[model samples]
Target: MYQGIYGSSKKHESDLDHVINRAFKSGVEKIINTAGTHQETIQALELCSKYENLYTTCGYHPTRCNELNESNEDEILKQMIDLCEKNAEKIVAIGEFGLDYERTQFCGIDQQKRYFEFQLKHLISLKKPLFLHNRASSQDLYDILYKYRDEIKAGGVIHSFDGTLDEALQFIQLGYFIGLNGCSMKIQNNLDVIKQIPLNKILVETDAPWCGIKQSHASYSHMNTQFTSELVKKEKWIAGKMVKDRNEPCTIIQICEVIHSIRDKKESFDELCETIYLNTKHLFFSDQ
Candidate 1:
């Protein structure tokens, strides 16, 4: 909810309340608002205060790693620690952080790695589960996390995962969960990797305002149902109606539906949903 439905700016600010309420009406029980910068984390905390079920993460995203440097690194990291300590109850994770080589143009490789490790070393004390991100930099990400495996007591999730089966297994073997979203199910290979991951190691998310499932995606054909909300262009925005092509938490049902369709038939949809729900609770909401 930090950005408007369009995601690039605050053009659709008025529609946010309706969008969140719609998600609840559509059966989404909780949401974890991920932040990529200090300011965004503050905004997320503000939003979380407004909704009891809404929680958040605090850290710099790999693409946004350029914001950190030797000059401000200590100050920024201190701010992150302060935010986590102050909002420990609401801050469930210490990321949206990790390496992202696919978009290294935003931040060079050295800068990304330096700051990513900086946060890992500095924030591990929070002992909160991580909300990780990885894209085309799985090897580096795994290597870094593997080094700190013993220190990461609360474990983490490789959110928006779009990696191979081996990569997924490696992370799971490290006691991390694999988060799947529209982006994770875009291709046939994505579906194949997801199919092999055990149910207990999987967590589904919307990655809203982005990663909306498309008809062209391999998993689209497997969806047995669709979100019934009427889709309208952002320019033609209407209250209670969804923006065209912009993902929201309400559509998370489709993610579960697609997974159920692709996964083994031995487990019924209800059973699969229960297993995933419990897995999520174990990782992110264990305190509750």
Candidate 2:
């Protein structure tokens, strides 16, 4: 089985090892990771190369877009770009970078503009696909992408898609695939959104160690549901019931479950898996 893993983790906590171990044990042999810093990307490369199933994408995050101006940014970017050029056989995509206005108010638009454009330029030259993360700044993100759509040698994916069907359609038009993860299964409203999206444009991700779905009812009662007064408690608990474990790639099955439920056909599991595997291979490994 082939699976995609997205994140920007540092060393010592690089979960790729755990994921590689589990994936191999479960008959999975491929993973695509998104790296935060130059050093992090190098570390991921070292680890993934050892495992043979792991691959990574290198880029700065929107929150750390400021790092692009640091002294190390150019040195690091050069190193990463050279690595991508020499080891194009190993890297899969070029991001985890985009706009995150919700989390990066201090960075300002210009900083994001400069860094994002810079990374996009490198991505264009490298001819590698991307893994983008856009939160609340989809308008400008789409604007830039559209302006350069034709020039982008390698199209990419939008990770953790949370936009409306209309917005989702926009990205689909640009040769970008939508990455559906556990987050899609958490919000009730997104269920319909998930159902509306076509399966061919979809790819499953876990975004492990973060972005897991939980039933809010399960969390509130994890310790005191029994002690609470009956009058205070409603017939049905809706706070938190199921907690998603952090940092395990095997949980990708949960994402498949969401797709199966929304598509309303169980037989699609095999087809779905094969389709996603083909999608990934076509997008990243076609030229390889």
Best by lDDT: 1
CA lDDT scores, all candidates in order: 0.89, 0.70
Residue by residue across 213-245, what tens digits does model 2's lDDT show? 454621111111121231111122222221123
How do the residues 173-232 of candidate 1 rate in per-residue lDDT, one tens digit apiece?
Answer: 999999999999999999888889999999999999889899999999988767645887
Specify the poorest-scoring 10-residue window by lDDT in model 1.
1-10
Task: Please state the error at residue 278 of candidate 1 in Å.
Answer: 0.6
The collision pairs in model 2 are 209-247, 215-240, 216-239, 216-240, 217-239, 217-240, 218-240, 218-241, 219-240
lDDT of 2: 0.70
How does candidate 1 score on lDDT?
Answer: 0.89
